[model samples]
Target: MREAQFYNKIEDLIFCNLCPHGCKLSEGQNGTCRVRKVIDGKLYSLNYGKISAINLDPIEKKPLYHYKPGSLILSVGSVGCNFSCGFCQNFTISQTGETFFTTFISPEELISIALKYKEKGNIGIAFTYNEPSIFYEYIYDTITLLKDELDIILVSNGYVNQSPLKDIIKHVKAINFDLKAYNEDFYEKICHGSLEPVLKSIEIAYNYTHVEITTLIIPGLNDSEEEIDKLSLWISKLSPNIPLHLTRYFPNYKFQIEATPIETLVKLQRIAKKHLNFVYLGNVLLPSNTVCPNCNKTLIKRNGFEVQSFMTSNQCPFCSFEIEYIKI
Candidate 1:
């Protein structure tokens, strides 16, 4: 295990300041993440260099509609997470302390793999599948080495502390923050984390890198119209151009409920669209192409991961309005 970063020691107790949990450990105790453990009087990362999942996936799968639509990216993930969301989609990796399924890969080796995929329209690497922040050392090392050569993206729970987030977001090209809910009660009860830290993290990332948000609309949990209105309005305060994905959540992991109704998703989408210029639905068959906010013209078309860009340049083809993103 590699020595972890962003930690403090107080009277022989190791304090993990990686996230908001601030888990103070004593003699072989693990942090809330379960990946960082106190061993031999120091904090060490158990998930460091242990990659549980890796794949060359489409950028759209990251649900990043505005960034680079059709391009592919090399996505990798490690086990362990700070949050304990009951409806975690990738619970097999995210909620586990087990590294039995993980393959050890060095930072240099990951860079090599990303470079090999460049010719096949691969943009860069995405630290995804599981919570990437728990293994802070590995991500920092890899992104530091793989700078500028390829775009770095993260699909995160947004529970990370600001200092470490700022350290990494400056190097990151894009990120999809999972804003699970707008209520504090939901976060504390269902996710085992706080909402304020995630909000702060999102605010920080917005200034440093391209930011997008994904909210898995769980039935009767976070799908309320009032909450979505507040959520979208909050995002609009940041920037209306920031794409917000309202994903349809099905029962998974500990939350065994029915799938989200299509009608419910549509209603919330309408509510969110009032505050945000770009709001799209996911996890169901829906028309989610990017349209010009000014002219209402379809700029990018997507059918299940197959994307075709109609925008020849950065501006809209029909309206010539300046777009914040590049042609995909």
Candidate 2:
């Protein structure tokens, strides 16, 4: 295990400052995340370098609609999460402890694996699968060592504390932040977190690196038109070109609610289009294509995670209208 960063020792207890939860623990006790433990007044991350799953996935599968679309990325994840979302898709790893699905890899080996895929057109490493925020020490070190060679992408729930987040954003090339909802009540009751911190993370991340936001639209929860409108407005204020992905929610883990309807996703996409120039629907079998904001022409065509780019730059290939995507 690796020593944690952004922590303070309160005599007999160690306070974990990695996230807003800031779990304080006595010796032999674990934090709210159930991964960090205090031993002799020192805190250590039990999940460090303890990978539970790893795979090669499409950059689009990160739900990153803009950055180097159509390319594959090396996705790596460890066990444990900081939040308690009821609808967590990867609950087997995120909710349960690290005892299950035993797998291990060192930071150097992970970097080696990522480097080997450069010829296959992989952009870089994705700290995903589970909450990489909690594994701050490992990710920080790995990305620091690999920064000169590869792009670093983080697919996170966006519940991290600001101080550590600020320290790591420079090495991160892009992020797909999961904005569960716009309402604080939803975050408090459903995700065991707050909306304000996630919003702050997004705001801070946008200025530092490529930022994209995703909201899993669950029916009867955060699927209101007002919520979507507010979310789009906030993102638009940052940059109208900021890509917002409105993903259809699927019932998983603790939440027994049905999957989001196709009609609802279509309707919200229309609402988001009013504020944001680029909005895409996810987890549904729609025509995954990019359209021009000026002439309404199809710019990029996508099937599943496969993307066919029509525009070379962030501008529309047809009418020369500007698109907000990054070109590799």
Candidate 3:
């Protein structure tokens, strides 16, 4: 196990400042993440370099449409998540630790695995599947070692604290932040987290890396039109060009509410598109390809991960309007 960072010890207690939880633990206690444990009065990351899942997936699967369009990325995740969201899609891996099987791979070995996929269009490695921040020491070392050779991206819940997040964004190329809701009540009740820090995290991430937002629309939880309006408007203040994905939520983990109706997704997409230049639907069958914000031309077409890029450059082919996207 690796000794974690962004922490402090005071009067026999270890304070974990990695995320908003700010968990203070004694010997043998674990933080809210269940992966960071207080071993002999020192906080240690138990998930460091212990990979639970790995796959070569399309960049769009990270839901990152703007960065390296049509390219592939090596995605990996460790066990443990900071939040206890009832509707967590990857709860099995995200919610557990030692109970599940994991393979221990060194940083150099992991990089070797990533390079093997480069011939098949793998762009870079993504810290995903579970909360990447939970295995803070591992990802920090891996990304630091694998710097600049490939694009480093993160698919996160935006629940992390400022200091560590700033450090991570320095090397990260792009990130898809999962914004659960707009109101504090929903955050507290549904995600066991607060809204302010997530908003702050997004603002911080924007200054560094390419940012995109995703909100899983649960039936009665966070699907309100007022909330969507406020959410989209808040994102627009950062930049309307930032893509917003409205994903359809189904029964998962603990929440057994009926699946999100397609009609609701369509309606909310209209509301969000009003304040945002790019809006797309996820988890259901529909075209979520990149379209020109100025001329309404399809700049990138995606059919279940097989992407066809139409824009040779960052400018729209039809209107010649400047757009923001990274290509290889």
Candidate whose TM-score is highest = 1
- Which regions of candidate 2 fall more than 4 Å away from where they truly are? none
Would you list the rank order by lDDT, best first? 1, 3, 2
TM-score: which is higher, 1 or 3? 1
Candidate 2's TM-score: 0.97
Looking at candidate 3, the ten consecutive residues that score lowest on lDDT are 319-328
* Superposed model 3: Cα runs more than 4 Å off: 325-328
Ranking by TM-score: 1, 3, 2
My TM-score estimates for the predictions, one after another, are 0.98, 0.97, 0.98
Instruction: Point to the candidate with the largest lDDT.
Output: 1
What TM-score does prediction 3 earn?
A: 0.98
* lDDT score, candidate 2: 0.87
Tell me the number of clashing residue pairs for each predicted model. Answer: 0, 1, 0
lDDT of 1 by residue, 1-328 (tens): 7999999999989988899999989998988888999999999999999998899999999978888788899999999899988888899988888898889999999999999999998999999998989878998998889768999899999999889998889999999999999999999999988999999999999998888999999988899999999999999999988899999988889888899999999999999999988899999999998889899999889899999899767889898899874435
The runs of at least 3 residues in candidate 1 whose Cα sits more than 4 Å from the true structure, single-residue gaps closed, are 325-328
Q: Candidate 2 or 3, higher lDDT? A: 3
